[model samples]
Target: ARLFRSWKPQLALHAETSGKNAIVVTAAADLDGAVRDIVKSAFGHAGQKCSAASLAIVEASVYDDERFLERLADAVRSVRVGDSTDLDTTMGPLIAPASGNLLRAFTTLDDGESWLVEPNQIGDCLWTPGVKLGVQPNSWFHFAECFGPVLGLMRADDLEQAITLQNATLFGLTAGLQSLDPVEIARWTDRVEAGNLYVNRPITGAIVRRQPFGGWKRSVMGPAAKAGGPNYVLTMGRWTDSFPNCATSSTSEVDENAQFKEYATAWAEHFAVEHDPSGLAAESNVFRYVPLYRPVIVLVGEGANRDDVERCRLAAKVAGVTMIVSRDDEADLLERLLTIRPSKVRVLGTTSDAIYARCDELGIPVDDTPVTSVGRLELLHWTREQAVSETRHRYGNVRVRR
Candidate 1:
């Protein structure tokens, strides 16, 4: 945050990884695609690349199946780590011995920490894949970004949990989700916090013009300038005669239809009492909540009672974000998740073991309290507050307002 605030170059771009990227494989995901993408993303380039998938979050459905884990391990082991010039070499060495040492230091877990793949050293620059299990949101395995062939593997109870774990990092460089189901793909795309998002393809190897890579949060700044894209030049400096005006215009043409215009006017008037000009858009801090931004929030669950669903809807209203998707029937949950392209999804109500197992993924901290007993609004507020407090504690005096 300090770097973001202090640095002001012609075009400022910052990329930092505490340790590694995380990958998620859903139960409905194609095993072939999962294996292929995981290997290519995790160990590709000797896992020394910035975009390497350092953590693999596999759904319990597959993780519980020892055979599948074995298959993944075998594929990882098959990767030949040696000299880049060697024809048989599948993985390459670190840039320097310091890099290897740094990788080892970042990956070395403390007592009681889960170790999915024991840290096995083959050479100073080359090492076997390191996998760590039971990674908490605050765990170094989940937060640190290591540059090496070492990868952490954790089993999530469901897809949502997997996604939650995947997104826990402050870094949002690249994230990959493997699932054959279209709904899962849509939901993952919407929820995962990464500048470069990959659905079946490998997370790394983004094409210059095609992918247009950039990061969010601590990962980057500016317009997420794509290296090979047409806008890549924009980062170099203004190509136009006048300094470019990049502010987004909220202005839109008023509707000409009489009925629509009248309806809009009436709607505005009906809620006039709730409107506040000095909250988000305005400068006064008198505590009026007229939110200028309304983010999309998705609610994924099954067996949600009427009250639980209503509470979630009410929370969305209070928060000024649209509740794009809500599911109580497990059968159609995935379909609903796919249809609604939500950016921030909240788990609401009591969901099936399988449903939670599949879609309740986020890398942020988890609140396992039942929705019926504890309202979704309460949970959301608590999580946000916790995050804010933690951020403030870590980087003192960082101003954050909701």
Candidate 2:
């Protein structure tokens, strides 16, 4: 009561003692009246403590409730605004002019979209009216923490979006949801990220004594820095006087350099496995096929010879090679081969010399008889000779043995 009496000059005589703390009463409403009464007695000792009501999310159904708004407006108008020396004053100047400037800047963003009461109209001192209203959602104005008598309003498409937007802000200091639906209120109360969440009541009307007060995000700083809690202190004590080799201690020992070396070795080994074809062959237990720089042409009997084409395709897929098939009309096949531009062509059943003469005229290199039937030894030799001649013609400087 002594604390209340001391600050009563600046805050009117609405101060009360409810529990451990002193509280200064400002505005009271039906739903949050008990909580506000408790809050008044809790922080009442702080002379300059101005509990500003920041936001009020009225349900869409209450849009035409002029009586409710009028009552709120009347309560705001009735606030005694004056200097600390005035006994009848319910509000006083802010701690600093910078605070006043911040509040002014915030209110101005509403432009003509919202209503902002002039600070001077409310009191000769720095008491600004405790409420502001807007008809629509202004993204610029919706998200902020105005410490003083500044508030913003935004309409949601539905109750869900309203709850979503409420929890979207990084600041989770305190929040209030007003709804008659028990399930709806429960859903909001459970999901809202605020440290102090209230249902169907004003956020500003938090009981300081019964409920611990604190803010989240940038609103708070340092350890145990939450509002309305015991201020914390750090201390140190000496447990050991003897000097020891702390570096050799098992708990303190570290091998960061060795760990880094081990990681580097493992990474290098993994890289080698990924890039090396021989490693892949060893792992898969398959014959490693080496690819030529140029494409390969394989002469098959006909298009219906699916077995040979399948073999060629499998080999091409494995070795990353291209296979060109030759048909009966050699001219058409040569034209198709020109399209393919293969480096090596394996001719089946054709002699090397005859294939060489054809390739010489066409300016192509031939690799003769890479694979042939068991009884085609004579054909393979003849094909090899043709390949040698074709290679010599393709590179005139190189020699070919018959």
- Assess candidate 1 and give its TM-score to the true structure: 0.56
Candidate with maximal TM-score: 1
Assess each prediction's global lDDT (C-alpha) against the native: 0.53, 0.38
**Global CA lDDT of candidate 2, please?**
0.38
Q: Point out where model 1 deviates above 4 Å.
A: 1-19, 98-107, 111-116, 238-402
**Model 2 vs. true fold: TM:** 0.41
lDDT for 196 in candidate 2 is 47
Per-residue CA lDDT of candidate 2, range 64-91, in tens? 3565556555555656666768898665
Q: Tell how far residue 8 is off in model 1, in angstroms.
A: 6.2
TM of each candidate vs. truth: 0.56, 0.41
